[model samples]
Target: MNGRITVRIMTVVILYHPTMLLNLSSRHIPCPAKTIFGRRGPLVIEIGHGNGSFLRHLAIRHPDWNLLGAESSLGSVSRTFRRLKHAGTTNVRLYHGSGLFILRNVVPVNSVHRVYINFPDPWPKKRHQDRRLLQSSFFKLAAGRLAPSGSIWLTTDHAEYFDFSVANGKAAPHFSVDTTADPPAAARKTKYARRWIDEGKIIYHARFCKESEPAHPIKPTITTQPGTMHHAILQGTIPDVDAFEKQVHAFDSGHVILLDAARPLGDDRLILFVRVDEPELTQELLVEVRPHEQGVFVGVMPFARPLSTPGTRAAIRITSRWLEGCGLRLQQQSF
Candidate 1:
């Protein structure tokens, strides 16, 4: 809500470069091995590569395999980058957002050779069980993405979660559950796994092999386009800084929230921090309001690299209407 919020986000962008991170905003993932890694190899994904220890191991063990790591934590992504850089690992790429998004959107169907889920958060609380990743629905979803006879290897220290994954896999109708299997040697080499082993913890492991296609095959739903741009021009005066307030716009698919407004110290332009929340993805974008010859321009900046989705278009319209409420007349616009 404060101006300082923009400062924090800028600091993060300055620290991390774009080489290791995938641009989830892209519409289709045609061929990641050639596009991302600059070579062809089998695609392997690690659902939650904690600290990149196991991911680094995989890159070293199989240089011919293209490895992808999906993690939800920004700090973990940063730490993993440091480790990969130190080890000079090249076959690995990281996604610094939701693992589910990468699995659902970025990964091509029937292209993945293997998936490694090491020590996923158990979400032990009953109410939080729905948040766990290894659900029956996940097994169904993974089936549509994995290659024929491809497998998912899981290793966790929690007994209940291990059983939960096994039971869910059995119910999915796509995977053959194998509870009596030793995990890959790389699984126990993670930081948490090594510490748990030293403390004499019993770690559970399983391999869910993809047996067949889903009974009801699922397709990837992509509402965002890579090149499409949305914006609007209004004929009116600039909005009063004090009049800016948080506003929410809801659509059938998702909702967009205009969180706050900030004006640079010497610039006449205003920046609106927005949060766009959809079913599978959530993005933070900055909508810029700048003065034009006839009126004002309300649109997302090119630097934001925002994917043009329904929610995103609604965001620009919401901002334009808000400015109209502050005495701006709609002239010509695109949404």
Candidate 2:
């Protein structure tokens, strides 16, 4: 993979049309955005809708069923979005993140009618198996969220990965597996599935149906703030922040990384975007430490809604202490 080529392509797509990408964090609350095309119907999720080619046809074929694509790659998301928009389809929307993120946080539990995973990257290397998307944890999570009648459809060209997935699916406590020699014809219509078919490669397709919802489903709760603020206030003349350097702080619960720091000229506000990685949560948040009517306030920026958690509050405390090191007087604190 050429990094330069990818960067160039991503820059072009994002520069041309930025709004094509949808915000997964805000779209779905207790339920997904229902009423697509003025009709409420079953929801079909396609994870890693690579080029959006199959998605184009899938949406066209099932106008009534809402199609939600969860993809991580900005390039793929943008490309598929353009394709869907060109086709003028209204039943499809995309979530710009991992499949698990949307499933666990956004999509309503027991609401997904079907899920399609077509040609996922088979991280064939043994050392990279930890990164594979198909795992017991994912299966359990999927099972808890899927309807009683809901099913998962998976197709991959890698035989080893195919067998591995099937083994896990069969062992899932909440699912019943049905192996298919060939995936759905709609899947084969995609460029990926077609190329494999042209090469006479054997593609494995399997459907896993939910036996029953998990009796004790692990539905993690995200503690939300009233409006979108996670900060503390202080009063002092801000000292000069010498330099913006990479800094990492580790703790038992999780770790925080001060990735980069920035500030605008003639403005007393200092913006720092840091990555907070916790047990099951990962977020990159912009923290603002600047002058307030009282003195200096430190808080998560409202630009993006980051899940406020123990780690984030810890981040505020850590940032304040770091600021004290850089010359700040504490008047009051609220975290």
Candidate 2: the clashing residue pairs are: 234-296
Badly placed stretches (over 4 Å) of model 1 are 1-4, 26-33
Q: lDDT tens string, model 2, 259-330?
A: 767676888888777778875467667788888888888988755446666678778877888888777766
TM-score of candidate 2 to 2 decimals: 0.84
Clashes of each: 0, 1
Tens-digit per-residue lDDT, 175-275, candidate 1: 88888888777788788789888989998998999988765656666545567768899987776587566788897789999889878789989889888
Report the Cα lDDT for residue 104, model 2.
77
Would you estimate the TM-scores of all the predictions? 0.91, 0.84
lDDT of each: 0.81, 0.75
Model 1: lDDT of residue 268:
84
